[model samples]
Target: MPTPSAEAVLADSAGDAAFATTLAKGLVVLEAFEGAKLLGNMELSVRTGLPRPTVARLTHTLAELGYLTYDPRVAKYAVGARALRMLHPLLAGMPFRQLARPLMQDLAYSVRGTVSIGLLDGSSMVYVETARSGDVGPHTPDIGMPIPVVRTAMGRAAASMLPEAEAARLERQLEAADGAMWSGYRDLYRDGLRQCAERQFCTCFGDYMPAIHAIAAPLFRLRDRCFAINCGIPAFRLQQGQLEHEIGPRVRALAESIRVLVARPESAEPGSRGAKTQTR
Candidate 1:
């Protein structure tokens, strides 16, 4: 458990009013994403300490307005495109992709795989950028393609960035999913949190895409929100025992560099090549 500061304890004891609780908890559920990771309702329940039914109602309203997405395939939730639209004006003044590209390229080269940056959109992970060693594999997910939050490495790592209570609320979103999807959701949350606490990244094999092996790490903001970067390749082609041995450290390093760049906004110049154009 996190050791709460005196201020935090007092603030909780202040007890917000009913309408405040609804708005506060609703926004808290949305804040669960770091980049690509989506928090399901059950998971949201766990993270936010909000009731499962309350989360369901909140997410339902958000989804109806396209602020969050509900994916039946993975039975998870992600940020909606409309949410991204809201961030556009602020992101426009920043060179987010430029700051990320060099590190992503280095990670892809080191891992001999494809590397990508993703953002959370209501219940889906929107691929913002990518760098591949080459596209020789049978399956290569493209930029703008949305992946289910519960099934992908990027999604879990991103979700790990949320506050513990908020993370719990997002978990509540998972309770409504089908059995197979719920099982995967549970494993990803367990493993993703464990791996993130141990280091900066997590690894997965054939979870998101069959035959694809991947490693992902988080990019943190001053506000404590997290984003994600991932490196992946066809599992069949990787050298024996290379997955964790070589890829993990390299990806972690690249992720750290990106974190540094994000931390120092002055260096994030838009003129840099391979930079992502801010999305609206």
Candidate 2:
């Protein structure tokens, strides 16, 4: 089935069946990681909305190609070092991280909290780098920590731009989550993402952890692909309107600079195989 708008466009261009199928499935696999936790073969079947057998075959093929690695002991898969090795030239060629670091440090100093650079992984956000303010708070996220995407400003910022169906599926996962462990997010839940598409950022108060607030803005690679930057502020120091009034703009600026650097032909790295990059 095609939308009226899509039908008109396809009629005009003449439908290319092979192009459509391959491109669509490739994108499906890519999106499966947008906010997911670790996706095993079965989990990926659910996330990608693909059949189990298809997911298994794709995973097997990707693993053989050095893009994904299967850990038999854990029965899990993560992006292989080969995938990581693929990123080196891209990140190394361009100085996006280097340029952004100074700005992150400056923002951390001004805000008296912590600043971080992250990218979206499957259904979670992974922190690639972090700069903290003298360890002002407990529960500080380490460089490689992964956080639930539906629960963090960084993850929301990235996911907010996705299609509505994707966002809703993530919400279901959030709602289904149980235990006192996540009691903290209930209060901070905003129900729906607002102002994210327009602002290209998301702000959350005490969603990931009690007494911790954060502001996150998306960075871009080309024009629309979302990457992100975020600032973490402890509740103890948060003045009422600071996140929207001050921190938002600063994070957005850092994001913009990063976006510019990442777009350079040499700077954009191929994404990882199993694990996705942190979105924040």
Candidate 3:
């Protein structure tokens, strides 16, 4: 099924007395720009399922609040300065990211893959730190990108490390929230979990995209938060059994190394990238 809109995903939340629906609706308008950098009210209304008038009002408020910027010449809106305000503080504060970067970069260079650290967010995994060979350019995933919890080795690996009760609850929630996605990938995802249990890591071949093949392992709970590390390479570059036999173990070892470092966070200069974690 097509990914549900933010409105559809939050439909049940609207009924809560303290939900602040107006605030949520406004954020939904901003979220309509996910893969899209610019959109007008009609497009925003279509993406969000909000009426055009409501979209207009929310967009106006968002623009006023600096969460969005309006382009009169092109008649569109894009994410604005206020969003970066939150990003700056977040990218500057995480101590684990400082601890993880050198290792992630080392793996990225050695494996010629994009290596990323992702943190759980609601039911998804969002990239916290992403290191790529210089040649990969912008074609690969970046920090702040969100991938589904059950559809990725990164997400499933993280889930596998959770307490049994928490893992089962989140699995049920994901299946219910996105049944089509869950139903399609249930078996493959289960295999990933088994891989995690048997070998401390998971492999995903073409699950992310036809071009991307990846393996992942979780850092489990580190300093009260959970994170996963992933190494993804283009399918064209993947040798036979590379993801399963080679990269998978490498990623698991990377996770273990970071887990040890995170267990004992120390005072150190933030790498040039600084705080590379996001709890949200």
Q: Which one wins on TM-score?
A: 3
Candidate closer to the true structure by lDDT (higher is better), 2 or 3: 3
Per-structure clash totals for the candidates: 43, 15, 0
Best candidate, lDDT-wise?
3
**What's the residue-level lDDT of 232 in candidate 3?**
83
lDDT measured at residue 24 in model 1 versus the true structure, 0 to 100: 59
Better of 1 and 3 by lDDT: 3
RMSD of each: 11.0, 10.4, 6.6
lDDT per residue for candidate 1 within 116-140, as digits (tens), equals 8776543456677788776537656
User: Which 10 consecutive positions of candidate 1 have the poorest summed lDDT?
Assistant: 271-280
lDDT of 2 by residue, 13-94 (tens): 4476545653355335534554443568788877666688877877777778776678888776666566567656644543
Q: Show where candidate 1 strays beyond 4 Å.
A: 1-94, 177-179, 222-225, 264-280
TM-score of each: 0.59, 0.54, 0.85
The Cα local distance difference test for each model comes to 0.65, 0.61, 0.76
- TM-score for model 3? 0.85
Which lDDT tens digits does candidate 3 get at residues 1-280? 1234456556978567877788878877877787898999999999888899999999998999899999999999999988978876766766788889999999999978799988776567888898988665334888888888777888877666655555666777788768999999988887877777677788888886777888888665544455778888888888999889988888877877886676633223211111222122
Better of 1 and 3 by TM-score: 3
